[model samples]
Every structure is written in C-alpha cells, then in structure tokens.
Target: MATIASQIILHPVVSQGLKFGGTTLGRDKTYRALQYFSRFFAWYLINKGDKIEAARWSALKAHLGTARKLMRLGKPMEHLQAALRAAFSSSPALETITTIARQLGYFGYLSYDAIVWASTIKLINVTKETAARVQKRAFQFWVAGIAFSLIHGALKSLRLAKESKALKASKTWGEKDLAEEASRETRVAQITAARNSNNAQLALDIFDVWIPASGAGLVNLSEGTLGIAGLISSLLGAKAQWQSVNGKK
Candidate 1:
C-alpha cells in the first residue's frame, strides 16, 4: 500500500490509458471505462511506434473532445457522461472509417454500439464461412434434385433445405466450394428446380440491411436462383400487409 501511494505521488506522469504495471489499481471511473473498452480489442493500429488514431476514431471522438473541454476549465464535466454515451453509439472501426475507429473496434466490447461495430465485422467475415457452407449444401441439393427430378418430388424438400441455408447464412460460392465443379447430383437438381420454379427466390429471407460490399457491383437478386422465390415474396408481402394493418412498421 505504501509503495503504491509513493508511485502515484512520486512517479513520472502516466498517460490517460496507461497501466502502471504495478500492484496499484487506479480507481478512476474514466480509467475504468477506458480499461473496459480496451479489453475488446486485442490489437491496435500503430505507426512508427506510436498510436495514430485518437480523436478521429469515431463519433466517440466528438464526445471525448467535449469532455476534455469541461475538464480543462475546472467546470463540472456533467456532459462527459453524455459524450461517453454518444461515443458508444456505433462500432469505432466499421462506422468511422478512421484508424482510431478501426483500433477501438478491433475487439468486441461490452458497449452495445461497440458490439454493433464488431458484430457487423463478424457477420461480414463469417459471411464467407456461411457462403462456403451453403455452396456445399447447395451442391448436395443440386445433385439430389437432378437425381430425383425424374422421380418423386422428395427433392423439393431437399431443395428447400439448401435454399434455407443459403438465405439464412448468406452463403455463396466461396473459393473452396468453387474449387471443383459441384460434383453433387442433388445440388444440380436443386439448381434446376430453382430454375424451373415459377418463383424460386421465395425461400430466402433477405435482410433489408444493405452494406457497400465489394464484388460485382450489386447483382440483381434473381427469383430463379433459389426455388420458390415467389413463396418468400408472398410471405413477406403478407407480413408487410399485416404490419400495415396492425400499424406496426
């Protein structure tokens, strides 16, 4: 205890987010918040042995700047709390498009906004995984579809299953799935059924949340891509109608 007190009282100045590395725990609220925020990111952006992003990270920067002004004048930074609140409104990295934003959002945080930022990245990165899974599943379905197209409509259910994976997982033709021809007969059948269906795209639950994803720019979603696209269209249509009738947006 004596050693800790001596360090804070006699040691060199510590930066805002620095850990003293000794046994003394800093009991400041701001310090705690910074500590918690730092936990989410395992790595941070640095340039030439110094962190590059600070104020320009996210809208959080705006909040922190305001707080600093309050601290400087000896006036109660009552709005510091508010700034903290606002800074947490989005992921620092994905939303801000700055180095600080990216650094802050490197790891998941307890803050909802921070999580929102990190989760979006997770979703995007996991998108490839989902796509790969779906492609494999699609291959299986396509083969089944071809095998059973001449037989019972049992494949309709299988096709539906593959489409479900695709829509929900946002699965697509990832590299591994595309390495060789989808040798699965069921997958071919599934694709064929989709092409044959009057409303093949009906099976997908498309998230209205649009992002500026990189690829062939904005391919038009085709109804024939998945079987019974029209069915999903109808269900969504009905849901919209219900929402309208119930006054629920």
Candidate 2:
C-alpha cells in the first residue's frame, strides 16, 4: 500500500499538474474551462426540460464568471505595460501597430470590466442601465482585441509561409551550399513550429471572438454555441500553458 501510494504521488502527470496549477494563469484557465462547461451543460439541461438542474448549472457558470472577473482585477495595468512595450518593439510596422492595438484593446476591456465587477458587488454604486452599458463597452473592447489578434495571426502565418517557401527552395541548390544544409533544416523546423503555434492561437481567437461579439450585440450566437466555443478555446489555452510549464517544445 505504501509503495502504491508513493508511485501514485510521484506520477509524472500528477507532478506536471501540480506545477501547472501553481500559476495564476493555469488556475484561471481551469476555472474558465469549468465555467464554459457549466454553460454548455446548463443549455443541454434546458433543452431536456430539466429546468431545475439547468438553473443550478447556470448559477455555477455565472459565479465562475464573477470569480474570474475578480481574479483579473489587476490585469489592466499589465496590458497597459504590454502595449507600451509593443509600441517600441523593433517588429515590422504592421506587426508593431497591431500588437499595440491589441494590447490597448485588452487594457480598455479589462479596465471597464473591473468597473462592472465592482458595480456587481456593490463596491461601487451604479444604476442597472449604467452597469449594462459598461459591460457592453467592455465586450466591445474584447471584440476589438480578438479581431486584432486574428489579423496579427494571419500576417504571421503569411510571413512564415514565405520563409518556409524560401527555405524549401534552398534545398535544391548544388553541393556548394551543402555545408549549410543542417542550418537550413534547423531553421525550417523552427518555422514549422512557429506556424503551428500561430495557427493554434488563431483558432483559439476565432472561437473566443464569438463570446464577446455576442455580449456586445454584434452577433447572436446561442448560449450553447458560445459555451462550446469558449470551452474549446480554454482548452487550447490550457494546452499552451501546460507546454510552457513543462518546458515542452
């Protein structure tokens, strides 16, 4: 029994999960996954005519959302700092502009969202209409941020494609360039990895945009659809964070 318990405690997956859960972002991602799952389950329950169960799930989703909002209360300043750093980055003009814009959009969104959260908890007093307007504005900024992220991802993909083409074309050269073959192969691998990462991020943003768009009234996605989308994106984000935590390539 002791041996079995030690083995279980020392399992790699368990160790990795503990490391992952140690970070604020990881915890947030876990909560986000649960929140979206609750949303989807609630919708499923509703469709099955189980109003009592659906209400419980719906309440869980709402509470998770509120908790996430509280957790992100300090994020606006972080985004602002990121925007400032992006403004002075040596990246290409379009890339730099889009990066700054995206960061600023997130900064604005989180700032307004903090206010909405405060109003919700009565930490700050505001009329219902005012709160709704503030929440809508926050979603609008979120939509803008996701839009810019998509654009940035597209541009990055194009750039990587061009680099990949050039690298492949070099492979056909004669023995004169044979000495650099290994270097070229390494660069090609890096480019491929970058393209994959960029595509994954693009997909995540694409799925996530609908939630904010719906909140802002720019789109009318069903709650079930939004829930599934959010769940997918949250998993994607969690995977990325897991890789980071595990130092995986």
Candidate 3:
C-alpha cells in the first residue's frame, strides 16, 4: 500500500534481516537504496509480465535501483530522503513502487513464487546456463502452486461437506458413533480418491527442477538457499508413498 520511496525507507527497518537471492540487506543508511531496487523489480514483474512472477521481479529491480542510488549518494541527504519519502506518500500512482521498496526477507516476507523468480532474475545477465536454470525453476514454482491449490481446494470442500452434515444432524444424533459412522464413507472416499490420483511424478515435479541445480550449486544443504524446492520434493515424495498405502484401503 505504501509508495516506493516509503517502502524503501520503512521496509529495511521493518523487514528484519530477510535474505534470499544471495544478499543480506536492511533499512540502515547503507542498505536503503538496494532495498528500493529490489522492490522496484517486484513492481515491474507484477505489472509488465503476463505471468505474475515476471511482473513481480520487474517491480523488485526498479525500487532496488533507486534505493541503491540514494544509498551511494549518502552525503547529507536526510532532507532528500524525507522529500522522496513524502512524494511517494502523497501520490496514489506510486503505490506499487513504494511497496516493492520496503523489501522482503526470505523466511519473513518473500513468498515461494517471488523467491523463485528473484533467483531467476539474478540469473539474468549472468550466464546462459544460469538463465536457463532460473527459467526452469520458475516454471516448477508455478506448477507447484497450481498443484497445491487444486488439492487444497478439494480437501477443503470435502471438509466443509462433512462439517455441514454433522451440523445438520447435531440435534438428532444420540450417539457420537452415529456421526462417525455417517462421515466414514465420505472421509474414506476423499482419501481414497486423493491417493489414487496422486502421482509421485506429479507430487514431486517441483522438486525435480532443483535437485540437479542444487548439486551444481554445490551447496548440498550447506549454505546459500536452504534448497527449499528440494525440501518440498522430499516431503511430497514421502506423502505420495503414504497416499499409495492409504489408497489400497
């Protein structure tokens, strides 16, 4: 909601040492400009690209550039910082610009999608291979989001239907066992259906994108990224196995 400049100023302090894309940043006098640059990239990707991830990265680069410039110029610009801050605050159009400036930390602010795209953009202008990897990773992130969303929706729907039936029968049911008996078929059905539909490949698609890359990066869970994509894959693979067993019943 805040303007670009305000986001730059406010975010660094408020963001609380968030990290991703191989950078450590903050709201201190030094980190302010870089904050704006990253935010600008977020703003750009959010609006310009057909994909939400692309636009977000664009916005991030924009604000980060601005904030970085200001940080470099750091002479005696308390007044200038104040002015820039106010300009964004007064202008409604600068809303997205401002929000991007505030910056986001990995575990704290950056979402899974933003983190993936940002990593990809870091690949840009770096090397052909890196760019390719970034693109691949971003794609996997999208697929993961979509896959999770569909399954999540289905699960929620099943839950609501069960709850509604229980409520409707609340007054008439004498035994708790009756309620359990009534819901048993639906639960079994939902779980069985989910398990049957679960493909190990489908569940682990996102993880596959990162496994080779993680190996190439040489992190091996030692540093940089916690290899989030890899972690997700491992968990999903385990779930798929669990689902297979459940589906048999």
Candidate 4:
C-alpha cells in the first residue's frame, strides 16, 4: 500500500497537473470549463422539467463567471501592451493592422467588462440600464475582436501556404546544396506548424464569437448551444496553454 501511494504521489501526470494549475491562466481555464459545463447542464435540466436542479446549476455558472471576472480585473492592460507590440511587429501591413485591431478591441472589451463587474459587486452603483448598456458594449467589442482575429488568421494561413509551396518547389543542385535543402525543409515544417496553430485559434474564435453576438443582441443562439460552444472553445484554449506550459509543439 505504501509503495502504491508513493508511486501515485510521484506520477508524471500528477506533477504536470500541479504545474498546470499553478498558473493563473490555467486555473481560469479550469473554471471556464466547469462554468460552461454548468451552463449546459442547467439547460438540460430545465428541458427535463427539473427546475430545482437547473436553478442550482445556473447559480453555479453565474458564480463561476463572477469569479472569472474578478480574476481578469487587471487584464485590460495586458491587451493594451499586446496591441503596442503588434504595432511594432514585422508582419505585413494588413496582418499588423488586424492584429493590433484585435488586441485593441480586447482592451476595450475588458475595460468595459471591468466596469460591469464593479457595478455587479456594488463597488460603484450604476443604474440597471447603464449596466446593461455597458455589458452590451463589452460584448460588441468582443465580437469585433473575434472578427479581426479571424481575418488575421485567414491572412496568416494564406501567407504560410505560399511560403510552404515555394519552399517545396526549390531545387537542390547536389550534395553541396543538401544543407540548404534541409534548411528549407525545416522552414517549411515551421510554417506548417504555425499554420496549424493559427487554424486552431481561428476555430476557437469561431466557436466563441456567437456567445458575444448573442449578448449583443445580434444573434439569438439557444443557451444550450452557447454553453456547448463555450465549452469547446475553452477546451481548445486549455490545450494550447497546456502545450505552451509543457514546451510542446
């Protein structure tokens, strides 16, 4: 029994999980996954005529959302810094513009979202109408950010595709040029990886966009649909973050 316990304590998965949960973002992702699951379960319960259970799940979802808002209190400035960095990046003009726009949109969304949070907690009293307006504006900015992100992803994918094709078409003279060919192959591989990452992000943004659009009254997705979409996007984000934390490709 002692040997089994020691082995469990020293397991690699256990260690990696601890490392993952140590970061703020990792914790938020976990919460988000739970939150969205709650949302979906609440809807399912309601359809089954279980009002009490549905109410409990709904409350859990709301509380988790409030916790996430608190966690992101100072995050707007991070988006602002990202915008500035994007402005100075050596990307093409359209990509740079879209990237900066996306970051700035996030900055605006988070700034307004902070105000909504403060009002919710009674840190500063705002009328219900005002709070609703602010929330709508925040969701609007979120939609814009996702739109720009999709554009950026499309442009990046196109650029990477061209680069990959060109690299593949390049000819090597002989053994002397073998090293250059190998270098070209490496660059092509890097491009492919980057394209895959971009594509994944694009899919995540696509799934996420509808939730904000519904909030902004631009669309009317069912609660269950929004819940499932949010869950999928959160998992995608968590996967990317996990790879980053573990130094994996």
Best candidate according to TM-score: 4
What lDDT tens digits, residue by residue, belong to model 3 across residues 104-161?
1111111333433444446324466664655455344334334443444445445556
CA-only RMSD, every prediction: 26.8, 1.5, 21.0, 1.0
Q: How does each model score on TM-score?
A: 0.14, 0.95, 0.25, 0.98
What residue runs in model 4 are displaced by over 4 Å at the alpha carbon?
A: none
- For each candidate, the alpha-carbon lDDT, in order, equals 0.34, 0.94, 0.42, 0.93
Worst lDDT run of 10 residues, candidate 1, spans 207-216
Per-residue lDDT for 22-59 in model 2, tens only?
99999999999999999999999999999999999999
lDDT of 4 by residue, 156-179 (tens): 999989888888788567898988
Alpha-carbon lDDT of model 2? 0.94
Q: Which candidate, 1 or 2, would have the higher TM-score against the true structure? A: 2
Task: Write down the worst ten-residue block by lDDT for model 4.
Answer: 164-173
lDDT of 1 by residue, 17-131 (tens): 2432221222222422333233212123222233445223323433442343333332113223433453666633322232222222211111222222333345334465654
User: Any idea how many clashes model 3 has?
Assistant: 42
Model 2: residues with Cα > 4 Å off, grouped in runs: 172-179
Query: Which candidate tops lDDT?
Result: 2
Preferred candidate (lDDT higher): 3 or 4: 4
Runs off by more than 4 Å, candidate 1: 1-227
